[model samples]
Every structure is written in structure tokens, then in C-alpha cells.
Target: MNNVINWFEIYTSDFDRAKKFYTDVFKLELTDLPVSSDRHSQMKYATFPVGVNGIAGALVKMDEVKPGAGGTLVYFDSAEINDELSRVEAAGGRILRPKLNIGDFGFIALVEDSEGNLIGLHSMA
Candidate 1:
């Protein structure tokens, strides 16, 4: 097995609002993905920029899927977790937990995004 997780999706009810929230929080500029004919009319999605070695994921708006604070949690790579934590509230998010040492791993913090999605931030600093 090369990787346990190949891709991830953050489902949202409001595509534009969620897109804005993510872009503002992580400074991510997402791009629209072309949906197949079979799914085009039913859903819409935008993907985060993929680095040369980074994983791929997307923000999806579909009738069956709903975004919230439960289920899978996605931890984003952070160069400065504290700095990001400071911006959470201003970005329309709430800090669920402050940055704390994770033994030999580094530091981690939890936050709830504007769309009510619980997300994690990890950093080595």
C-alpha cells in the first residue's frame, strides 16, 4: 500500500461560503473541478492546490452529504499553528483546543470552521 488516504472531501451545504471560509483561514486558492455528466447536475466541487508531493482533497456540495463537526477529522499542515489559531475567530471559526505539545511529534490544535467542520492544525514548530 502506497498511502492509506489518497484523497479527502469536505462536504458543505453552501459551496461559495465554505470556499471563502477555507480560503481565508488557510490562505488556499481552490480551483473548480470539472464534474462528470452523470454527477455534474447533482453536485459541485473545488479542489485545493496540489503540491508536488502533497495529498489531494476537495470541498464538495452535494444533496446527500452534509458538513458538520462529526466524523472524519482532517489535519492540515501548519508552519505556524499559533499564528493560524489567532486568526480562527476573525476568520469565522472557533478554536476547539489551543496548541499543545504532542510528545515527540510536535504541536496540534483543533478548530471549528465557519461551516461547522472540525479541523486540526499540526506543526513542528
Candidate 2:
């Protein structure tokens, strides 16, 4: 009822590659998140840095979770959509859509990350 979404997980087949892509684009290092139980040894993940009150999220890799386009699209907040879009390709991501004005809402751009996930970048400019 509050924020509606509390946490999110971006599934990936390659942990290191995905980590690099995210870190490069966002310019933030992701901390390792351990899978304590043996039952989940096949599963691996790392968490993105978040403020105390900010939403929690992680990059997860597991056999059951297939990373690809479609399904739920996660939008990342950006101060400059065009600047971020410029970094997408060099970071191992392909731009699906160039930065476009959204009128009152500002701007947005879509891209596919290294692991084939369609992620959106939103900005006020």
C-alpha cells in the first residue's frame, strides 16, 4: 500500500558480466550477496547499493531464472538520459530506444543489458 514495490531482482545467466555492465552504467559498485543454504548453492547474486530508506535490489543468477527481453521491465533513475545512453554500448548494452521526451514526465530511453534484459532509463532532463 505504501511504495508498492519494495525490492527487485534482475535475473542473469552471467554474474560477472552483468555486474560489470550495471556498475559501469550506474557508476556504483555492487556488493556480493551470499547464498547461505546449500540448497541454493547453484544460485548466485550481488546487490546494488541503496540508501537506508531506498528500495532494495539484486542481480541474481540461477538455473530456474532465465534472463531475456520481455516480462517485467525495470526502469533505473538517471540524472541524464542522453549521457547514460551514450555509455550503454561501451558498457556492453544495446540501445533499444534513443532518449525521447515524455512531455511533463521528462525523458526516457530503453536498452538491453549484457544479459539480454530490457532496462529503461528515466531522467528529468
Please tell me which predicted candidate would have the highest lDDT against the true structure.
1
Following a full C-alpha superposition, what root-mean-square deviation does model 2 have from the true structure? 13.9
**In candidate 2, how many Å is residue 114 off?**
30
What's each prediction's TM-score? 0.51, 0.51
Error of 2 at 40 (Å): 6.2
For 2-53, candidate 2 gives per-residue lDDT tens digits of 3434445688888899999999999998988665333423767687877586
RMSD (CA, Å), candidate 1 to true, equals 13.8
Model 1 whole-model lDDT (C-alpha atoms): 0.72
lDDT of 1 by residue, 1-125 (tens): 23433445688888999899999999979988655423323667688887566566678775544678553457787777899899999999999767755443456567899998777786768
lDDT of 2: 0.70
Clashes of each: 0, 0
Error of 2 at 118 (Å): 16
